[model samples]
Target: MLKEKLLVLVGPTAVGKTKLSLTLAERYDAEIISGDSMQVYRGMDIGTAKATTEERARVPHHMIDIHDPDYPFSVAEFQQRTEGLIRDINGRGKLPFIVGGTGLYIESVCYRFQFGQGGSDEAFRAEMQAYAEARGAEALHARLREVDPEMAEKLHPNDLRRVIRALEVHHLTGERLSEQLKGQKKQTPYELCIIGLTMDRALLYNRIEKRIDQMIEEGLVDEVRSLLNRGYGKDLVSMQGLGYKEIALFLEGRCTLDEAVELLKRNTRRFAKRQLSWFRHMQDIQWVDVTDMEKISDHLSEIHAIIAGKLTLDR
Candidate 1:
């Protein structure tokens, strides 16, 4: 039984995964499938740091801008779409590369995670949703942390849907979703090579700050304004994403613009910390620390050599 080959690139945000991924994909003549949960939505380019027009023109990318901002996309849906894309890319004699910082989405594809079928309690779910609306996502997430620390660690506070589902699973089955996930086999039907990028925490945080400032300059606030003007409310999951939610608060007069930007920076830093925590526990990842690299090209060369040893190519 021949297995398809997959190259996975994952790391915390603002870690220069994008430039490195493009270089690697271009070298291997591969297509990219975004492992990001947010990049799939249309009209979310700047905030998500989507590949630029020239970059996409150079190498085909899949799983980006495929859905409306209000559309619901589960990890199951992401896994299903990624499975098909991998098969088709391999069938066409091209390599498939998965790139993003979304740990669960990436892990679901790499490990072939079988989502559990713990029955739902809609009434309970609604109650939890209302609780979140009243108190806040962070407060709701704290409840999850108490009940299921492992799942809470993986979830962002703003990920209300998954957070509620975790609480609901615990309520209905009297078992933690994380514990149920432990019973599933950790095996994949593909040859997967996962590469993780890392650097000094201080430097990475500086990068995050700079990235947010760049996003603001790139018109992220205007982008949020456009979405809201088109009736995409803050309630939409996409609007609840990092940049969108903060900017939406400013637009809605809930927070001053300065306060919103400051909060965006603070929340984004916290999110990056969580992302690093998730990757730290993952097994079999080749971590590359670019703490001293002055240019992306330098990092690209090191990554290319690493991938060349890990993945076989038909030259």
Candidate 2:
């Protein structure tokens, strides 16, 4: 049996995935499904760098603004929703294009990774949360590193939810979360064409910094403040996202606006590094160097050629 065709564009934050995705989706008659983890929350527009209203008017997008900030969106839920969206988009005789920077969420869909169904321990989860609150997120992450260094390496110390989940997996099943993931089948159920964007490390970092600055200029602090005013606590997973957390500190008087901006820039640079590292480990990505911004049409043509050759799309 033949598999459906799926097109994906992935890269670190501010590597120009959004611009490229819009052009590709328009050219290929595709509907985009956001592979981003944070973009799903409502009212997180400017900080997540979500497509503008005009962009969405040009082409349909999915899996964005579909949840409240307090909702606990897992990789499993992302996979399920994306699969459904893919089918629906394909049924309409259009391509399903996934575009974002979230690595694990995208990879789980691409490879059909089955997360282990170890039952949850509420008390254990609460205790872990308490430990993080008391000793700091790094201290909690250290406990996971003792058991699953590979996973600990992939997850940032500030990603307390996933760190706790990894520890919980070990607590319940005696098997490392990384081991469980490694043991899953690698076969994809699609004729997958993944396009990875890259650029010089220094240039990419520069772009990330500029983008964070732009976000601040575009009222990113106000966006966070609005969310907070609406009763979303800082501890919520959504509030803990890259820009939100740092800016929330400023709003709470824990830091100055300048300090928060600098922190957001620094953390985002590290995040982009981690995103690139994760994507490097995945196989069959047709990497494209997009450092030359002046020749974007040339880059688009190259990507079009790759999609045409790989997925046999009509020119």
Candidate 3:
């Protein structure tokens, strides 16, 4: 049996995860380690919904502002770093509270899904990109289906990045991606209590749109401008996220601010839908209905009670 408890807080964008996480952490006497993909960048704050400095000070948070926008960080790297930190936190007699809405990142820890051996090959990837361009996405996707049909089913047909990475793993390992992930999950070494935050779809979308508006009011455009002036472009993996991509399109005159904002809202809504799809498959997840609570304390108390009970059962 594992020696400690690792609690995960997961949900979609603009679900008030930050607010709830701070309160939960205080109640459980835990430190927050972010599972967000975009919030790691130092200057990309407004778009990523990174915690404000004052809010971060209220509850010690980790894994935000740890990189420059120009620096690439991957899910595999996040898995490695988060595992080490979780071990350290447990060693110190503290619960590892992994909080954020990035479903894949949280799943990485819970499932211990290995990205694969070695690392990304830029040259091989360029060749594959050319192949996808010359041939068709289906051509490569067919290849993935033969090896990792399960993953292909979960991914969309037009999702080029995931398709390429799935194909790349096969090229590198000569082992099927599905088999690789299956092997990893079978041998996962930890016991986790995963908590999911859920709310009504309409409310979630409204919050997403309002959050985007708030970001713009707080100078999201200037944040993007600074990153570009420092030499990052939309092509980089880190910069290709929803908010940054639309903002870059606006900055480069490809679209009007209004058009970009509309696209951001639509894409973010779609992203939330995808997140719900992803988390719905997660095993042993205890979901807390956020809107059910009348006040913040009620929500925190609900979450705290669940976690406390789970930890006791773990012991």
Best by the lDDT measure: 2
Model 1 bad stretches (over 4 Å)? 295-298
Descending-TM-score candidate ranking: 2, 1, 3
Residue runs of model 3 more than 4 Å from their true location after superposition: 117-122, 130-163, 170-183, 186-188, 293-298, 313-315
* C-alpha TM-scores of all predictions: 0.96, 0.97, 0.85
Report RMSD for candidate 1: 1.4
lDDT, candidate 2, residue 175? 91
lDDT of 1 by residue, 83-147 (tens): 99999999999999999998888888888898857867889988998999999999999999999
lDDT of 2 by residue, 1-315 (tens): 767889999999999988889989998999999999999999999999999999999999999999999999999999999999888887788999999999999999998888657989999999999999999888998999999998887887778789999999999999999888878787889989999999999999999899999999899989999999999998887888899999999998999999999999998988888899889988779999999999998998898888888796654
Those runs of model 2 whose alpha carbons end farther than 4 Å from true positions after fitting are none
Better of 2 and 3 by lDDT: 2
Q: What is candidate 1's TM-score against the reference?
A: 0.96
- When summed lDDT is taken over every stretch of 10 residues in candidate 2, the lowest stretch is 306-315
Looking at model 3, residue 257 earns an lDDT score of 99
Q: Judged by TM-score, which candidate is best?
A: 2
Ranking by lDDT: 2, 1, 3
lDDT of 3 by residue, 219-271 (tens): 98898888888899666666777788789989999999999999889978887
Return the TM-score for candidate 2, rounded to 2 decimals.
Answer: 0.97
